[model samples]
Target: MNLTIQFYTMLSMIGMGAWVGAALDTYHRFLQRPRRKRWIVFLHDIFFWTVQALIVFYVLLRVNEAELRFYVFIALLCGFAAYQSLLKKLYTACLEAIIQFCVRTYQFFAMLIRNLLIKPIIYLAQALLALFLFLLHMLKIIFLGIYKVLFKLLWMLWKLLFIPLGFLGHLLWKLVPQRAKIFIARYAGFLKQITKVKGIILKWWNAIRTRLGGPRE
Candidate 1:
């Protein structure tokens, strides 16, 4: 818990520092006069960078070797300060203000993206959900269509043929004993005949189709 709190505090500090740094950069670049106070802006930049660097250094020290890290931190701070001032010369006097404005603009967009992109990760997970639902609905419709056609075919068969077969089966079942060895024998023979007839018909159909240049069964 202590570590969690420390980490949160550190994160908050970094966020606040970034906000301040960006604002300062914007102010110095655009709103403030460039010729008026070069020394002041330089000093302000140094101070803010130093505070930020110190915070960073402190955070690192808590997790790193102290002596070597402190030296590195100092060197980094010096480099950071130098870079901040050097930007004025590097980007050219005319473009310095524009560059500063661009930095602030980038920061704004970055913050915007961070907030906007992560919020709906779970809720908006399926941008494809609607497509999935549509596909499911289409599949259901297709299945139902096929089912209705099949049911109609079966209904016709029952009316024309299966009803009679059912009646015949019922009569046989009633006349035959509930436990009949002969019933099993007859049933097996009937199945074998049906299979043999089907195979013969299929072979004949294939032969006919082949002669007619149609697909084989």
Candidate 2:
């Protein structure tokens, strides 16, 4: 009975070791090297070793009353060696195929969502923008037309007022006293000085523009 129990324990330990090997391979392939996070990698290592230790301890406890024996270690090593030699390639290939399938499935769904949902929203926004621009352009044209009409009316009013005012001023000038005529002459001289200064500034501005290769205004 004792021999039978030991034999079964060895078998169980071997199976457990194969499972551990497969788990480590999966981690290396999918999680360990691919992820660059230190804390996460530490956690994965800790969890993997902790679970393996617990499993080992439990199996030992059941089979050999938790006795630490050289044969138990040997059995585990043999199992791991067998897995590496016979099963590693097949398991890795299957794992890679599964990963590829999952990636393809995700991409298909993403493309579907972009076509069905995102594309329509983008098109609707563009149409609304075009409509807004058209309305703005129409409003600008209407306002410009109204401004031109108002400006023409105001210019006509200014011209009508200026002609009457000019005639009144001439009549007043003829009726003024001699002393008042002298004051008006002084004011007229000041106006001529201002016009002379304005002409000089315009001449200098045109020279600067020509030197800078700017078109004459």
Compare the candidates by TM-score and give the number of the best one: 2
**What TM-score against the true fold does each predicted structure earn?**
0.26, 0.61
| Per-residue alpha-carbon lDDT of candidate 2 for residues 102-140, written as tens digits (9 for 90 to 100) | 999999999999999999999999999999999999999
lDDT of model 2, residue 21: 86
Among all windows of 10 consecutive residues in model 1, the one with the lowest summed lDDT is 64-73
Q: Could you tell me which 10 consecutive residues in candidate 2 have the lowest summed lDDT?
A: 208-217
CA RMSD per model (angstroms)? 21.0, 6.9
Q: Which stretches of candidate 2 lie over 4 Å from their true place?
A: 1-8, 31-51, 58-65, 126-134, 171-217
Instruction: Assess candidate 2 and give its TM-score to the true structure.
Output: 0.61
For candidate 1, lDDT tens digit of each residue in 88-116? 35544546767779899999998888778
The whole-model C-alpha lDDT of candidate 1 against the native structure comes to 0.62
TM-score of 1: 0.26
